[model samples]
Target: MTTNNIDILGLAEINVNKNMLRILEHMVQDKFKLYFTTEGKKGTGIRFLVKKEFAVYVQQFQHFEGRIGFIDFYTKKKKIRIIQAYINVQDKEKPQVKRLYKQIEHWTNQCLNSFVKDIIIMGDFNTKWNEYEFLDISHWRHDIFNYFKKHFIKESTLVFCDDISDMYTYIPNNPNHSHNKIDYIWCNIDLMLSAIDSKPRDVQPVIKTDHRMITLDLFMDDIVINKNNTQKCQPSSKTIYCYDEMQKTDGEWNWDKFNKDIIEYLDNPNIKLTTNKIRGINSHKQLNQLWNLFRKAIIHSAKCNIKQKKMKVKQNCHPLYDSDLKRDLNMLKGMLNKIHGTKLDFNDRSIENRQKIIAHITALYRRSDGNKSNTLSDFISITKRHNIIISNHFLHNKTFQYKDILQDTIIILESKYINATYEYKKNIMNTFIQERNQNYKTDKKKMIKSVLEQPHTSLSIDKVYKNDNNKDTFYTEENEVKEQTNLHFQMIVSAINCEKDLSQHPKWQDQYQSKHDVQHTIYSDLMK
Candidate 1:
């Protein structure tokens, strides 16, 4: 990376287990600072190597084990966040792989809630390069890419810059051997201005490596506002955890048919048992030891037999507001309005006015920022009280005006309003999130009901046969194999598109009953 003058490098599929991954993380270097999959991980490993100069600006580091992660850097009044991912090689149709895509989507959701404007995601996505077109609906519209279609990712758009290329990252030793361009670099609208180009590095000796390095060059000065002249917002750190191994117990557990399922989970050799210090379980030393052993057995079996979900707990900072945050956000919004109304021609174009608007936004971001309960989600989203999807990009081109100052500002702030009818897009987005969570909490089984009621036929075969890290699945042909995915869905996830256990799928219900006929529901007797 240093030889290539690369300041930041992302390495995916490091091909090491958790123990080895931990060892590599400890083996530090002088020149480059590393961010590894410390928590919330799966698969192999993904890491980031940042030159010391840039590494000093790193505000936070996070990742999803062997799959994806990101590093946040604050420099020159701009936040340059790099999200690195290793999309594993697997059948896309499985529910487990879909979990990976959903996890990516979840990570992107975090990006939107951020106060920082420039976000870049780069890594080996494992997209079927030759099988798809850059602009084809099948490619971006597919559940794989999800929301990336709206923003410039691998392809260039009139609004954003991307170095279009047909170069492949996977090269074979023999020239006749097949290869593919599976790696990609994506930037948000703000970073698009600084994106010089993204392309594959020169093909190296195929015997030395199968995958070539990909790089993106950015004109940092172009995107950054002078930090000396700008007021900085106190950055919020979003905590990361590895919950992918935890089971999702939303759907009812079928005790009658769970005998063989529980046995399979318990018998699996890969089940890792760790002894952590416990409290309040039992006072006696012997009983405490016995209780811990029993608890471990139960949890290990549940994780293997039931569905598991890998997720990053979202940071909610609204509670940090001391009645002052709300007032400050309103004041910031009004100040932004005054700038446009006072001067029609020069207001939006003037760098001073733009800087003031940025300051106001940052002020709101830092309001009551007593370093408590804050997170990386864009503060704009939660500062408001209402459900709306976050809106379009702001400041795409020269002079950074979207159609004009008023329209551009509205695009960023007015997602909640239908036809400019009401409020900030952030508020609207937060409203939706809150509503979804409330609904899920009110009815844990609602997701199961919704999943069962939905028209399964309407969904494509790929959608119906989903992938998840559960052993009870029966929809696919590869049932006998031991498969694991570094992803799990929550209650809202199940409501959206959660797969049912083989015993619960509507079509197989009748046939599986006979499979269920001989089995009986076993209950633990508390009275005894």
Candidate 2:
């Protein structure tokens, strides 16, 4: 029976910080059979109030936060489905307001699913009709009006109040703004006809709220007449018109169940997870941790590469240059050859070799510096020679190209390595914890004794080397020692391999080589 489109904004302002509670109070005071709010955050704040009579058979209620200020309420009304809501203004070109308008359109489009019956959309639409019988507005407003037209939501004022003298349902409180008809109540034509007899009188209520409250009444005359005539009709032959109001239907759709099903499908190790499944939890802590580690590795590798380059520069600028620098020159040339057009081959071995060579050269230069008799020219000559080698290598292979290829390849390799390492580390950590837990359970007494035992310095050799004639204890001790050693070795090997793999990764070549003129040109154009 409730048909008035209430201005929740006015209610919100009155309650201010206590908006939710205040709205609840208002619904109670007005004896609202059903209620909804657009101000709710993510639909959590939305509340639905039902009269006691109606609440009994009301199986479930559902609401969705739609575009703009819109919230769609779905309810089982006497077993018949109904959708109710207000729409926000759609003005998509005005810099500050386009986003809100687009959101409304999105919601409207989503609501086009056919299951909802008796769709009644009513609210304060801060807009005017496109083809007005009297006034003209901007083209953008007309465009918005056309959008509604396309959606088949006819202008409510034009359809319902065309014959009325005072067609306007809204009054501008501000003197500067124009007075226009902006409020409306709209429904499908068939539903509108069915409720014609119950229409409310046109005397708008001037409550504490700013906007005038209008209402539509739904008459139950047919229902009353049928009930009265039921005395003469046989119970078996009688048709039940109000039975829908007494029956309960299915509950509202559970989106959480759907989400849970999706997550299970993806996280199930037995089942193969797809790309679509992974996209669901983008900001999950586990995935974020992996990504963070990968990012850090990339940054560390880049820093190492940069440091090597800087060192090479310094070496080139050294004053004491070798007259027969051909040996050093050949080494540099050979390194460049291995790297040329091979961006993806720099694994642990290559990285270790590069680092070792850089360290050796740096140490030599440092030793030379420590010698008091060494002059600035000695350092400058050495540095200049190295620089020449590097410069030549850069020019010959087209420095930009190789550098780009190397950078890209390194990034890709690092990301893959990080992902693999994360899983490996997780597994190892879990195993270690499990083993410790098992030891605590099986050998609690011995573990305690070991902790309380005298220090190795204080213990006599005889006590330390006591022969455990008991086979079980000796076997247990041996197995424990072997297990501990194996675990330690595994940890050491994993750590070493991880470091070696990362250092030797040839990903930088891909990044380095791809930065050449040809690639750069293409990249620049794409960016533009």
Which candidate achieves the best TM-score against the true structure?
A: 1
Candidate 2 regions exceeding 4 Å error are 1-15, 19-23, 26-50, 55-112, 130-138, 141-145, 155-157, 174-178, 197-206, 219-528
lDDT value, residue 54 of candidate 2: 40
lDDT on C-alpha atoms for all candidate structures: 0.55, 0.41
Each model's TM-score? Answer: 0.41, 0.32
**Taking the tens digit of each residue's C-alpha lDDT, what string does model 1 give over 57-165?**
8999876645777887776546667788777655563555566677776766665543233577777777755465555546432555556755434432222323334
User: Among all windows of ten consecutive residues in candidate 1, which has the lowest summed lDDT?
Assistant: 479-488
Model 2 has an lDDT value of 0.41
